[model samples]
Target: MQYQAVVRKFGPAAEAVEIERAALPVLRRDQVRVRLLARSINPSDIITISGAYAGRTTLPFIPGFEAFGVVEACGEDVYGLAPGTRVLPVRGAGGWQEYKHTDPSWCLRVPDGLSDFEAATSYVNPMTAWLMLHKKIGLRPGMRIAVNAAASSIGSILIGLANAVGVEPVAIVRSEESRARLSGSLEAVIVDRADSDLATGLAGRHGLDAVLDCVGGAHASILAAALKPGGHFVHYGLLSGQSIPPSFWSSHPDIAFSFFHLREWVHSEAMENVQRAYAEVAAQIAAKIIATEVREVFPLEKIRLALQSTLPFRTGGKVLLA
Candidate 1:
C-alpha cells in the first residue's frame, strides 16, 4: 500500500518534494493507522528541512511534528482506541501525509469542540507555552513578563495563558503593523519597536519578572535588559537567525538564561508525565482558555503553499495542511 506525502530530500536548498505514492508500512502490534485530517506547518518544520536543527534532522524524512487524525485501524495489542476516534499524533515526523502508522501511546484523543485545525496544532505550541510558564518560571498571578515575537502562535498562547492566571503580559512587537493586528484581540500591553525601545517601554510601566523570547539576536538583548534583577529569560526559538550575544550575558550578570526545547522534555520525562501534561493542555483547549487560530488550510498536495505562508514572520495564526 502507498500514501501521499511531502518528502524532504537530503542536502541544502532541498524543497519539500511531493510524493503521490510513498510506500506505507504495515502496523506493528503497538501501533495504529491514522487517517490524518489536518497538520500545521511550524517554524521547527522549516528549520528541520533547512538542516539547521543542530543536526537532529535526518534526510528523506516527512516533515511534520504534530497532526490531527482519525484512528482508521489498530494493532492487536492496541486496545481502548477504536476506529473513527479522532486523535492527535505526537512524537513523530511524518504528519504531512494522508496516513500515519505510530504507537497508540503517542496519540492523544482530541477533546470535543476543537476544530481539525485546532486539534492538529494543539501539541507543539500549547505544550511549549504551558510548560515554560508553569514548570520553568512558575509564573504567578500579578507577575509581569515580556514575550518577544508576541504575535506568534506560541507567543499568543503565552499571552492567553498569562491572562488566564492574572499575570501581566507585555507583548513586544517589531512594528506598528504587528501591534495593530494584536491590539484588537489580545488583552496585553502591546509595545511597537518602531515607537519605543523594549527596555524603555517595559521599564516605564513595570519591571519584568521573566522574559519568553522566541526571537533571538538584538531583540533578545533588549528583552534581557528589560528583565528585573534575578529574573529568568527563556530562549526557545531563533527566529532572527542570530543567537544571544555573549556580551549580554556578561552585562546582565544577575539574570538567569535558559534554553527550552519540547523534544528534550518529552525524551527525558516518563510517559505518564507527558500524558498528564497533554491531558491538562487538552482540558484548557476544551475550555477555550488555550486556543489555536487557523490562518489557512491547504490540502496535502498544496503543502508547498502552506509552508510558504508561514515563512520568516508571524501570520497571526497557524497555517495548516489537510
Candidate 2:
C-alpha cells in the first residue's frame, strides 16, 4: 500500500521538503502500524530540517516531534492496543508521515472524547510541564516557581499546571511583545534583553523555589541569580547557545542545577505509570486546562511548505501536518 511522507532536501531553500509516495512500514511482533491523523510541528523538528540535528538523524529520514494516529494493525503480542485505537508515540522524530511503525511499548492510547489535534500535541509539551512541576521541582501549594519561555507550548501548560497546584508561576518572556501575549492566568514577570536592567528588576528576590529554564546562555545565569537559597533549577532546552557562565555556580553555593530530558525519564518509568500520565493529559485536555494552539494545518501535498514555515519568530501556535 502507498503512504505519504515528508522528504527533506538540504539546499539553498530549493524544495526543502517534498511529499513523496512511500510504502507502508511493516509491523513487527513488538510493533504496530499507525495511520497518522495529525502531527504537530515542534521546534525540534525545525532544527532537524535545518541540518543542525544531523547527529540524531540519518539522511532522508522522516521528521516530526509528536502526532496522534489510529492503529491500523497491531502485532500479535500487542494486547493493550488494537486496531482503530487512537495512540501517540513516545519519541520526538518521524511522526510526520502518513503511517508509522512503532514499538507497542512506546504507544499511548488516547482517551475517548479527546480530539486528534489535542492528542497530537499532548505527548511532548504537556508531559514535560507535568513532570517538571510534580516530579523534579516538587512544587506545592503556595510555593513560587519561575518558567522562562512562558508563552511557548510548554510554557503555556506550565502556567496552567502551576495554577492548578496553587503554585505561583512567574512567567519570563524575552521581549515586550512576548510579555504582552500572555493571558492573565498567572503572575507574569517580563525579562528584557539587557542583563543589567533585568538583574536589577529581580534583585533581592527571596523564596523563589524553582526555575524552569529553556535558554542556556547568559539567561540561565540571570535565572540562577534570582533563585532563593537551596532552590532548584531545571535546565531542559538550550534555545540560546548551550554555554553558561562559570560564575553562576560559584556565586550561588546554596542553589542546585540539573538537566532533564523527557525521553530519558519516560524510558525509566514503569509502563503503568506512563499509561497513567497519558490519561492525566487527556483529562486535562477535556477540561480545557491544557490547550494547544494550532497555527496552521498542512495536507500531504504541502509538506514542503509545512516544513519551511516551522521556524522560530514566524509562528505563534503549533504547526500540524495532517
Candidate 3:
C-alpha cells in the first residue's frame, strides 16, 4: 500500500489536496517501483494544481513535479539498474506518493553526495537553468546576461554557471535587502529595482546580450528594455500573475522572446538527450559548481502546510515534502 496527496478538484492546491491510500498495482516488465523519499514544491507544481493546465491534466491527480527516491523493485527487463539505487522518478502523475512506478527511460539516477532534498528539487530549477543557458542562449565566455528574480534558486544557479565560464551576469532583485543576500564574490553587477532609473540605466550600459526572466508582466518589459538589439529574452515563469504588456512587443521588436516550460521540454525531447542533460546537471551539483537549497522538509502527512509554505511572492529557499 502507498499514501499520496490527491487533488480531486482544482482550486487552491493546499486546500484541494487530500491524503489517500492505495495498494501497489501490478508492475510491468519494463517498470521500476521507487520508494519516494522527498518531493519539492515549486511554482510550476502550484500552477498545475490550480487548474491552469486542466486541459491536459487528469482528475484526482498527484501534484508533485519532482521527487527523489530509492529503487525498491525493478521488473525483469529493467537491467543495469539494480535495487537500492536512488533516483528522481518521472513520467507519471508525480512523486507526492509513498511510491512511484516509472519506466526506466525518463528516470534519472541520483549521483552520490546529494541529499534527498537536493535530488528532489534538482529537476525543475537546475535543469531549467542548464537548458536555458546551454541550449536556448548558447551562452559563452564574456557575454552579458541579466537575471530577474536574482535571489531565487534558479537565479543563483544561472549566476554560478556564468561565473564558472567567465560570462558576465547582471542580477536584478526587487530590493536592496534581497541584493544583500547574494555573494559579493561572484563578480556580477547587482541592481536594486527600487531605484527608479535602474531599468533605463541598464539599457544604457554597454548593453546586455540576453535576459533570463521568470517575473513576467510589466517587469518583463522593464528587463527587455535593457537588452541590445537582437538580444534573446527567455520568459520561464509568471510570478506577477499578469501577462507581459502589449507595449512590450510594440516597444521592442528586435528582442526575441521565448517561453520555456520545463515539463513540455521533457515530454518531447529525445530520452537520450534528456539523460545527457540530467547527467550534466548532476555533475554540476555533485562538484559544487552550483548549489540547491531546502528551507524546510515536511513529512508527507503535512501536505497542506507544505503547500502553504510554497505560495507565490514569498521567497527564501525551497520547501520539501517527504
Candidate 4:
C-alpha cells in the first residue's frame, strides 16, 4: 500500500495536504526504488504547499523536502546498491511518499550510525546552517555573528557549529518565554516583536560582524541595522509572513545583503562539492556536534495532527512523519 501526502491546490498546509494511496513508481533505467522510512515537516514545506513559491512550484505534487529510506529495488542498469541498504534520497521531489524513485546520483548512503529519525532530517536545516555559515558568509573562527529565531533547529545547529569552529554567535529571540527557554544557554537578547530595539541591544554587547536572520519584516528590519559596515546580512526565512522593506538596501549601502535558498545552491553546485558538504555534516551529526530534535513522530495517516504541532520556533522540536 503505497501512500503519499499530496497537495492538489494551494492553501493552508494542514488543510490542503491529503494522503492518497498510489502505486509505487516504476524504476527507471538509471534509478533505484527506495521505501521511505521517515520524513520531516519543515516551515519551508508548509509555505510551499500553501503556494508561497507558487511561481516556481507545480501544484498536485507531494510536499516534502527531506527523508531517508532503504533501497528496495534497482533498475536494470543499477548496480552495487543492494536491498536493505539505508539511504537518504537527498532533495527528492516527493519525500512525503512511501516510495521514491530517483537516479542513484541523488541518493546518499546513510551511515548505520545514524538512526532513521536522524537520517530523515539530515538535510535542509543542517545543510542550510552549514552553507550559510561556511560557504555564504565564509565564517571564520572568532568572528561575531547573530542568528534570530535563535531557538529553532537551524538556529541551534548554527550555534553549535559556530561554537565548534570558535566563532561567537549571539542568539536574538522574541519574548521573555523564548528567552527563558534559552536562558543562560548563551548570550541572548530578548526584544519585543512589534518594535524591537535590537540595534541598541547590540551596541552594549558590540555590533556583529554578520547577522543571519530567518524572521523577516520588523525583526529583520531591526537586525539589518545592527550589522557592522561591510558586514553581511543574510535573510533565509520569513516566518512573519512579511518582507523586509525594499528601502533598507539603500539605507544600508555599506552593508552586504543577500538571501539564501538551499535549492538554488544544490541545483547549481557541482555534485562533488555538494557531496563534500554532506560528508562534513554527517560527520558532525555522527559525533553529536549538532542534532535535530524530534518532538514527536506521526504516521502518514496522522499528518494533520503532526502539522498542528509545528510549534513556533524554540520550544517544540521538529515534527516528523514516520
**Against the true structure, whose lDDT is highest?**
3
Model 2 over residues 67-118: C-alpha lDDT tens digits?
8899999888888788998888765577867888888778888987888888
lDDT of each: 0.78, 0.77, 0.82, 0.81
Q: 117-156, model 4: which lDDT tens digit per residue?
A: 9998889999899999998889897688888887777878
TM-score of each: 0.91, 0.90, 0.94, 0.93
lDDT of 4 at 53: 83
Candidate 3 on 6-84: residue-level lDDT in tens?
9999988878889888888888899998899989888777888889989999998888888899999999999888899
Q: Per-residue lDDT for 207 in model 2?
A: 66
> Between 3 and 4, whose lDDT is larger?
3
Better of 2 and 3 by TM-score: 3
How big is the positional error of residue 83 in model 4, measured in Å on the Cα after superposition?
Answer: 2.9
Off by over 4 Å in 3: 184-197, 200-203
Candidate 3: lDDT of 152? Answer: 84
Model 3, position 270: C-alpha lDDT score:
92
List residue ranges in candidate 1 displaced over 4 A. Answer: 8-14, 183-196
Superpose all Cα atoms of candidate 3 onto the true structure and report the RMSD in Å to 1 decimal: 1.9
* Cα RMSD (angstroms) for every candidate in the order listed: 2.4, 2.4, 1.9, 1.9
Report lDDT (Cα) of residue 138, candidate 3: 93
